[model samples]
Target: MIFLKLFRESFLFAYDALRQNKLRTFLSLVGVTIGIFLIIFVFSAVDTLKNNLQKSVNKLGSNSIYIQKWPWVNNEDSPWWKYLQRPTPKLREFDELQKRSQTALAVSYEISIDNRIVKYQSHTVEGAQIDATSHDHDKTWNFDFEDGRYFTEMESRSGSPVTVIGHDIAADLFPDGGAVGKALKIMGRNVTVIGVFKKEGSDILGISDDKEILLSLNFAKNVIDVQNASYNPQIVVRGKNGLSDLEVESEVRGLMRSIRRLGPNNEDNFALNKTTILSNQLDIVFNVLTKVGGFIGLFSILVGGFGIANIMFVSVKERTNIIGIQKSLGSKNYFILLQFLIESIVLCVMGGLFGLGMVLAVAALVKAGTDVQIVLDIKNIIRGISYSIIIGMLSGIIPAYFAAKLDPVEAIRSN
Candidate 1:
């Protein structure tokens, strides 16, 4: 019955205090509101980026693996100035790996050059990339043809000067329609356009395949010959769905090692690219960002806690004579402590709820405007509330204890 009375008195005191200083209370919660807003917004934006990147990767087929001289995603420091010093992997080794590995569903190779000009009649566009690939390239890369058909294996092997244009290239060159069976000049070399491809959106890697033109590997080699044309082609491997990506990667590595006759202690000269691995790495990066955001937001909560502590201390100082009157009326020390503690908790909980509402409103706005998924899970709310209560307790402990232990005679005489 004493605890119930104390609880009611505490709530009444808190309500009266808030009603008397509404503007000050709102201003005190501003820090918390801004902190939660930043954390929630960053979380939603990063999640959106991750989802879009994963979707693009899935569109390329999850069971596919890419073999190249450089890492596929997030690779820096290529040191292209020392290209002569870099070791080149051989195409013969790929063939040997294909023969030895049963997990490989299909293998294809391609050569690429960036910023090649394509001209159709009077229209010309620069900065278009050229891809020289085998007939199996479409199947390996999941390329969808918009019109006409992919080049035949015979045409690829025979070094036919036929080309397939991406959607953007087609639109730019043949805006008036009828692009097929037309002659186009690629890098000053005349090639016949046989097909056009569908438009794929820009990816996280900044690659827009819709702006490229595809030709036979042999034809590309003849047009833009550098060195080791057959041995240094970019290799792509497709695996069956049931096969483990790790197993396929290991098998390919072992076979390449054997075919290249590398020494027992030599490091791998080639790189294997996997989309799932990149996705995991991206998750790790986001996890770190989230942790940093949490820590930064925690500072605002700490400030709010300090504000609660200061307010409780001032309340105790102002009500010293009232505390003396309550003590003389036979109120226990624990009753006094409970009143102050409950007051602090009330203020903190109100602030936390307000912050949470702000977070939800921002998340809703993000969802309505963008395709980003901003989930407001129970875990986040629970965490916020729990932290608020803990802060309240820690901040109120000293002030409550001081108010409870004050001598009635001294408190009444002093103020």
Candidate 2:
């Protein structure tokens, strides 16, 4: 009952302080508000960007390995000419690995070609990303169709003039739906659309599935010079459910070495790259960003803590006579300390809430104006409040201690 009364009185005192000197209180807490805003905003943005990138990378494939002539990132230890001379993965190599690999659930290959124009009679859509893909490629991509079905294995092998259009292309060419079985001139060849990809909205990172069209490998070869090493045709393999990705990749690597006729003494010429490479790289970068953001926020928060401590000291000095009166009335030293501490904490909390509100407002504005999504999650909110409480307690400690230790006789005489 006593603690409750003390807390109530402290709350009123804190509220009255703010009410009496609104501008001064706001000015004092400005540091805390700015610091919290910076830290939370940065954390939220970095996390959202990381998630977006990971999602984009996932669209490439998960539990899937890419066998290519060149590594995803250039190797500093090896001569560039070594990789330059390596042969681009071929359909025959894909077939050999598919026949031999035990850990793989699906094996396929794809080659990206130059962007080309597509037309459906009068309606024309230009600069559509095209991929020439072999059998089981769609399985590796794991696309959920918006309309029609994936091309049959026979259609893929025989180099049938069929194309699977992305959502945007489908919309542009056949807005009324029923894009399947429609004859569209793609890259000067009339091909029937066999499948349409689901809608994936625009991304600032330029990673979107809605702008691509898939073609049969053989059909693409006939149209473009895919045999050129610069085209970078890659063989993709998916791991079995029970198998580890590394195990699948290892089996593929051994099969590839044998198929390439490389002896045990020779180094494996081709690179077996995983989609997780992009994710791992991005994680490292985000970790660095987190550290940088932390340090930058720390400096501002330190200043804010000092500002709060200064406010507590001034508040104690301003209310010294009140403290003496309470002590003379038989209030305990601990109670005086608790009251001042609670008051300081409440003030800090008010500032923290304002800071969080500002962040949420900016987050909403960003979401409304841009494709980038900034989320102020529950975890962040809790963290902000916790920081506020801790800072408040630390800042108030000295002032609360001094107020508690003051001699009631001297304090009352001075006032």
Could you say which candidate leads in TM-score? 2
lDDT against true structure, model 1: 0.76
- Tens-place lDDT per residue, model 2, 1-415, is 9888988998898898888878877787887777777778778877787778767666766688988887877556867898888888877888888898888888888887655788998998877788888778877776778888888888887899998889999889887889999999988899999888888776534667688888988888787876667566888998888777788888888898899899989998999888677677778888888778767766666677788788788888888998899899998999999999998888888878888889889988888887557856788778777888888898888999999999999878867
Model 2: lDDT of residue 329: 97
The C-alpha stretches of model 2 lying farther than 4 A from their native spots are 75-78, 175-178, 202-206
Candidate 1 residues 1-415, lDDT tens each? 9778777888888787778777766666565555555555456556656767776776665777777676655446665444445455555665676678777887777777777778988999898888877667776677677887888888988989899998999999999878899999987788998998877756664655689898888787676662354335677777767987787787777777777678999876767888787778888888888888778778888887877788889889888999998998888898899999998887777777787888778778766885345666566677777777787788788999999999988888867
Model 2's number of clashes is 0
What's the distance in Å from true for residue 376, model 2? 3.5
The models' CA-based lDDT, in order, is 0.76, 0.82
TM-score, prediction 1: 0.69
For candidate 2, what is the TM-score? Answer: 0.93
